[model samples]
Structure formats: C-alpha cells, structure tokens
Target: MSEQTPALSLPLIQPSQAQKHVTHNEALMRLDALVQAVVLTRDSTSPPADPVAGECHIVPSAAVGTWSGQDHALAYFDGTAWQFLTARPGWRVYVLSDLQTVIWDGTAWAGEATSLQNLSGVGIGTNSDSTNRLAVAAEASLLSHAGAGHQLKINKSVATDTASLLFQTGWSGRAEMGTAGDDAFAIKVSADGAVWNTALSFDPASGFASGEAVQSGPADVTPGRLMRTDYGYGPGNVLGVVSENAGIPTGAVIERGSTANGDYIRFADGTQMCQFNATLAYISAGLCSAAWSYPMIFASGSMPNVQGTLDSDSLALTAPSVTVAGVTGLTVSGLGSTNVTLNVNTLAGASFGSGESVDLRVLAIGRWF
Candidate 1:
C-alpha cells in the first residue's frame, strides 16, 4: 500500500514553529463556490439555520404547499410537517350515505319518484266514478245473511251526500195477476195519502171478476148503443154509452139534445160534453152551443170521430119534425120546441130524413162513426 511519490524540495517547518494562518472568509467563500458547482440555490449567499432548532427559516406562504422527502419541495420552517395541499383536491362540501346510496341533504336523504296519477284513475274501486261502490274486493258483508235476506247494491261515487244502499229481493220467481181471471186486487189509498191498502171490487160485466169491467159499461153495452138498466134507480134503466172515450166518474156522453143538455154537440170551440153518474146522473155539458172555458180534446181529436147518440128514455125530445142532413146531421131549425111528435128510435144512415118542408126533425147525424 505504500507507493513513494517524488516531491519537489521545500523548506520544512517543524510543528512547534508553524506560522499563524489569517484567511477565514477566503476559505468559506471557496467552500461555497464548490457547493454551487454541484447544487444551485436561489440565495446561496444566505446562511442556513441550525439543524437542531430551525427558527430562523423564512418561506413564502405559497411555498409551504409542496414537499419532497427530507428537503421540502418549497421552503421549510419550524416544526411543521409539509403538506402538498395545492397539488391535491380540496375538502368535500356535500355528504354521502353508504347505506342508502343517495346524496345526503345533511338533514335527510331524498329519493327518486315512482308513482303519479290523475283523479279518474285514482278513484276508490272503479277507475271512473260512474260504477258501483268501491268496496273491499270479494269481502264478506257487514251482517252476514243468516237465513233468507237481501243484499243492497251501492254506487261507486259515494263521496258527498250519496243515497243509501237500495235493497230489493227484487221480483219474486213467480208471476203475478194470472190470466185465469181478474182477482180485482187494487192499491187503494185513504182520503189522505198516509195509508194504502190492497182492496178488491167485484165487476158485474166480468161475471164475478172473470174478465175486466170497463168503467164505461157492461159487456152487452156497445158504443153508440143505448141500453136501459137500473143500476140502483126506478127509472135509471135509461143508460147509454157514447162511441167516444168518457170519464169513469161520468157515465157515457150523448150529444143528442139541443140548447144546453145535448149530445154530440160542441161549444163554439169543440170540447166534449158528458154526464157524470153514480147514484144519480148529473148532466154536465162541456161542448155545447155556449162557450166552455176549459175544453178537453176528444179521444178521436176530430169532429167526424166525435161520437154521440140520442135516446127517448134519457132525453125528453120535444119537436114536431126535424130534418137531419145526410152525413153532417146538421139541423136547419129546432133548437128547443117540445111537442108530442119527436121519435128518437131510428135506423143507421138515416136517423132523420132530409125534408125541406119540415121546420125540425129531431136531427142527430153527428153520432155516425
């Protein structure tokens, strides 16, 4: 390991007599120059602080944001561990939930919508309000039917003042009012409507309720045909039916006479004239020669269809001779002249012959159907 190198001759000073060295700054400057040749500093002239307690270091606030191991990326300082905040993301403001997997509102978490609907579709049972009541599907009744009972059907739109449930054992399985005969069962009400009763009335023409009894007459009584029978009177056999529909309270009408009590006659305006009869017949002429205030339309609605007849028993005819026009039955005279010469029984098509020589011939032709 010892290799001897040649050195030029120099004056050898002994250790006891070394001369004093005076250049301290000159050596420091030379050491700095050598350090700058390897690692350059922005301010290499400034001296570093002591490594044990570094209070003398001064760095810009921006420089503290960076670091690199032992030497900070920027300036380093007293007891502070360097954090590179400017190079990384900032702190988060919003909160998140791991369990709910929703963005937290801090107060509560919100979710996405699932259902929305219109009024028609959101009704109780039926989608629309027109159907029956929306009840529990196939549920039992509030009061189960122990024996034979009825069920009430309800409407669907029972929101406000809806009606109560209507119950009916509706119609029974059997038919009513059989065709054998008229049982004559009828709904009868009291004078006041507070009470109603099922009553029966025997009809004579129906032969003990065998058929229907028209309020007009018995079966033998034909329209425009006069029959005399005492319902409950001595001379009340003088009964007759007009060919027109008449009042049930009133017997058949007859436009037979003239002046006031007449048959088949009309007021200035044509209405119907009739006699209401029960215990006794009361002659109330609606359509007469005079004006009737309230006029009713005849069932036929026309003059030719209006039917009437004359009977010598019901009417006291007092005329000598009256001429009836062929179809019109219009009499030229004889308003009211009672003599012993009037004959009411006559054949069809010629109730009275047209005679210009006569003053009046009990004329009645409006009775022709």
Candidate 2:
C-alpha cells in the first residue's frame, strides 16, 4: 500500500513505524491552516517580524527571508517553525487586505462573484426599501453606454398612467415633466404641492402644443405670457373678420364686407373705410344735391370725413342749356355717422336747367370702434 494519501498527499502511518503521531499531527496542523481558509495578505513579500503561532499568509512572488522561493504558497507559522502548502485550482480564500473572497484560477487569484441575478435590492452608500429597488445616495450617478450613445427611458403601462420626473423641495413636489396622467407630454408646477398648474403640454398625434399659461387671444396683451400660434392672423384665417364687444376689439386682424352699392373695410387697429357711388340730380344752376346711407356705420358719436368727385362717364347737361358740365365745388351737409347729403356747385350762376344726372364717387374714412 502507498505511504501517503493521494488527494492531500498526507502521510499515512506504516505498520512498523514508531512515533506515528508526528505524521498524524502534521496532517491536523495543515488542516487547521487550510480549511475555511483566510490569509493576512496576498501581497507581503517578506514574512512578519513577529508573527503569532497559527498565523497564516499567502506568500507572493519574489518573497524574501524565510518565505523565499515559496511564491503562490500558503505559509503557516506553527510555534517555533514555518510550514508551506501548495495551493490548487478552485481553492477559495478570504483576503484580509481587500475584505473580499478570491479564488485560485491556476495562474492567479481572482475575485469570486457573490451574486449576479434576481437580487432583492441594491443600495450604494444608502439603504434601499421596497419602493426604491435600486437606490444610490451620492452627489451624482451616471449610466453610460458600453459603446456609442446612451438613452434612459421611463415607460408606463398604459396611456393614462404616469411616467415622469418630479422635482421637489422638502419632499413636496414643485415641478414635474413627462407623460403624466395621460399620453400627452406635460410640464406642471405647484407652489404648495396641493394645487398644480399645467404650464405646457404637447399633442401626441399632431405634435402641436398648448398650455394654460399661453395667451388666449389678442386682447390678452399681457406681457410675458406665451403666445399661441393660432391666436391672431395666421394660416387659414388671414383677412378674417374681427368682432367687437362693448367697444373692445377682439378676434382676427382684419374685417371686410362687400355690398351691391359699396364696400367697407375694417381693421383691428380701429380704422375703417367705406367707398361707394351715388347719383345727384341737378336742381338748379349752382346746386346739385343727393342723399345716401353709408354701407358701414362709423363708431357712435364720431363723424367720418366724406369726399366726393363726379364720375366722368356719368354726367349730363339740359338739352336747351349751355353750361360747363363740371362741378366746381363740393360740400357735405346733414352729416352723421351713418349717412350724409352731398351738394355739388357748378360754375356759379351758369344757366343749367333742372333734373340733370351727376354721378359722384364717395369715400369716407374714420374709426370703427
């Protein structure tokens, strides 16, 4: 039979051997240093100056003194002398210097992984609870890509569910941004944390945006409010009519209308104009008068300036009279906001019979408000 065991190379007692306890005690001593192994350090080249009995170390490369030529071996000090043991692959030892477990991989020692999957929680410099599964308490945290760019996404289960980043002060929410309470991306703010105001939101389908803080209409005129793109004159509503409620101009940029006798144009800036054609009948030599209503009335209590000139294509003279067929003077009487009377004067006292045609083009300009 062999004298030593095969696996550990422990010396076996021979039938005729005397002092067999020496070999048996040596086996126990080696087990005392190796089982559930721990090392004082894996980087000490020289042995300790005053090591206690039962103290153990893993001798490093280029070792000196009593540990010379014992690289990668476990050194155990037992009372008066030192003993060495060869380590094998799959041997695990707790390193005191690094406070971690390392395994021998035949060539070098490497850290042994404690756990890698299905962890209950992970906390770095902090304690994690059920709500916060992976919490990190630090000045900053980074999640970088292994290669190329990185993206951090927060997803929700449904459209009505919230997925947002909330900013807080003293644990009370002050602002938040994301898809909150709906699919639309929204930013909301609060002063007291109880009342929240939606500052902005975007439509998911059309990518258009709206908000409560945006200016509602042109009359809002308040400084520092966000302007809505559809507030005033814009695509599809250009030159559309504006409205007035109690003299306050509201709605689109311009207003206009056309009639058989005339046309009127009104603007958002309170300006208005009316243009029309009227026919006057010559009553006598120096007087021709006509009355007509304005297509659009000016603002109440305001009188519009009316001007007239004869249409060159629509003038006539009495058959038996020879008078210059041109108007020398034009004046307006009975003037009001909505109507006017036109008086035209021919060459003074020139003979012209009654009932002759004199077509005049009239224009009035004033305020609409």
Candidate 3:
C-alpha cells in the first residue's frame, strides 16, 4: 500500500495510524491547491511582495527571494506558509497571465496547440474537401516573403499535366493562364464556361508566341504578330535572297543578286527589275545590235519592258575625225523574260569605225512570280 496517489502525489491516510485527521486534512489541502489549478504567471522569477492565501505561481528559472532553487515548481501560498508542488511530465495548467493552457514536458512548459504539423486538412472560415485540402474562404490571400523575394510555383507531375491559375466570375471560369495540357504556356478565355478559346500560346523551347489575334493588315489599325522569315512582307525591311510570293499591293523590301549577265532585283508582289551595261560595234552606218542576258530569269510568259541610255562619251570619235557622235535612238526587239536584243542608232547617221566601240546602259522591268 502506497501512501500517495501515483499521478498527482496526493497523500493517502495510513491504516492504524495515529492522528488520521491530520493526514486526511493535509491531503485535502493539497487537493485544494492542485485540482483545476491556475497560476498567476510563469514569468515571475521572484515571490510576490504580498501574496494572498490560495494564490499560486509557476516559479521560473533563476528564481530569487524565498523562491531560490525552486525553478519550474508550482508555488502555492496556503494561509500562513508556502507549499511547492513538483510538476510532472504531461501536467496541464491554466496560465492566467498568458490566458492560455500550457503543458509541462519534463523540461519546460509550452502552449498546448502551437505545433500542428502533418495535418491532413485545414480550413479557415470554410470546409475543406478532399480535392481542396487547404481551403481558405477569404476576400484576399497574401503570401509574402520573410526577407527578400517570393515566388508562387504551380507544378505538375508530367509535361502533359496542367498547371494554371484560373480567374472566375460567379463560380464560372472566364480566363486562365499557364501551362495547360502541355509544356507550353497558354492563355485561354471562356464566355460561358463551356466553350474555350486559346487566345495565345508560347513555345517552350523557342519562346515564340502565336495566336489568331495577331494582326496581318498593312495599316496600323491593330496589334501585330511576330514576322516569320518566310512570310511575305512589304517594303522597308532588310535586303536578302527571298523567294517570291503574292497577296498584297506592296512588295518585298529587296531581293537582289548580281552575276556576269546582269543584276536583277525581285519583290514579294512579283515586281522584278534588271540592269545591264555593255559595249557594241556598229554593224553598218547608223545601226548596231547586241543580245542582253538577265542575271536572274523572271516568271515564265512575262515580257520585260526595256530602256537604254548611252554614256556621255559612248559614241567613239573617228580616228582621223575630231567630231564626237551622240546616240539618237535605241530600241529593244525580240523581247523575252531571260534575254532581249537591243539596237542603237547614232546622231547624224554616224557609224563606229573599225575597232571602235560605244557603251550602252539598259534597264528592264517585269514580273518574277
């Protein structure tokens, strides 16, 4: 037969003992100070100057005055003297100063419900479902950083999985943005929550964006889309080697090349031009003929309009004669897309003497596509 309670150390009356009333009364006093006990504070390191009867306090570490060497003990003042109770592990006490319940864990006291880790669900002002394990029904939710910066990341299990933020109106989705159904980022919109329209998308590897909302008109009436190198474009771009295409009144910026035959330029709108310069000797008085080949061939079945001009000193002077002959007329015959024949006539019906030459500049314009 033990003489004290195992849990609270409450004294028990001994059988066949003298003065049983004294032992019973001591047990009662102990019970009065302990059952449903409360302490004034756990922060006081010294005894109160004037403590009333039944008043108690949980003595903290390094206690001074009459409480020296009584750290972590429940100090109870019973009328004429003080009684100290040794708190055991898992003992709970209502702290009046802190207005909360604290529990002893052999070492120190701490709030009863401060640590809530590994909870399956948590709801604030709402009920949490299985899918939405942590639901917060509030006007706004803020996730701020502790020191520097913050990032809200939504990750998916696989590339084909969706991870996005959806904006809603009256519980109906209206807009969404993120990687949906694939790795590429996409922005989609819905009017009635039934039919969805992909307004924009970005490639994951190249980051190139594409959408039907991209404008393709010539005027600056709307926003524009990114231009592809192969797409047809109007003037005012870089000059490069590009294939010809049709669709607008404007043409390519400039697609040009040079070769032994002649230099040629083509545009997106099928416009082509060729320039060439050559020297010829007169076959007879007042006439000379030569064939001109284009550097680049034009579209088939297209005849180019040709024009020519003679250099200032193109008509050579006769060896013995000092008079200089000038060009009078120039004509193009046997017109073709790739080549043409040019004829030149000099003023005063002058002819180039033997071993003499005249310079001719020619221009031809037509279609290339």
Clashes of each: 17, 0, 1
**What is the number of residue pairs that collide in model 1?**
17
Clashing pairs in 2: none
lDDT of 3 by residue, 338-364 (tens): 888888765674454555555678889
| TM-score on alpha carbons, each prediction | 0.15, 0.76, 0.73
Residue 247 alpha-carbon offset, candidate 2, angstroms: 7.6
Predicted model with the maximum lDDT: 2
In what order do the candidates fall by lDDT, top score first? Answer: 2, 3, 1
Q: Against the correct fold, how does model 2 do in TM-score?
A: 0.76
lDDT of 2 by residue, 1-369 (tens): 898777565678889889999988888888888888998899999999999888998888999999999998989998778899888898898999989998889987889978759988999999988988988889989888978989889999999899999988998999999998789999999998889988888899988777777776656757767876556557655578766666665666778997865899888778889988777767777677888688888888888988877555445433234333545545899888888888777664455466665667888999978
In candidate 1, residue 105 scores what lDDT? 36
Local error of candidate 2 at 86, Å? 1.7
Tens digits of lDDT, candidate 1, 15-110: 454351313333333233222121222222232433222222212223322322312111222234321111111111111221222222333223
lDDT of 1 at 141: 35
C-alpha lDDT (0 to 100) for residue 257 of candidate 3: 84
Task: Give per-residue lDDT, candidate 3, residue 327.
Answer: 52
What is the alpha-carbon lDDT for the whole of candidate 3?
Answer: 0.78
Candidate ranking under TM-score, highest first, comes to: 2, 3, 1
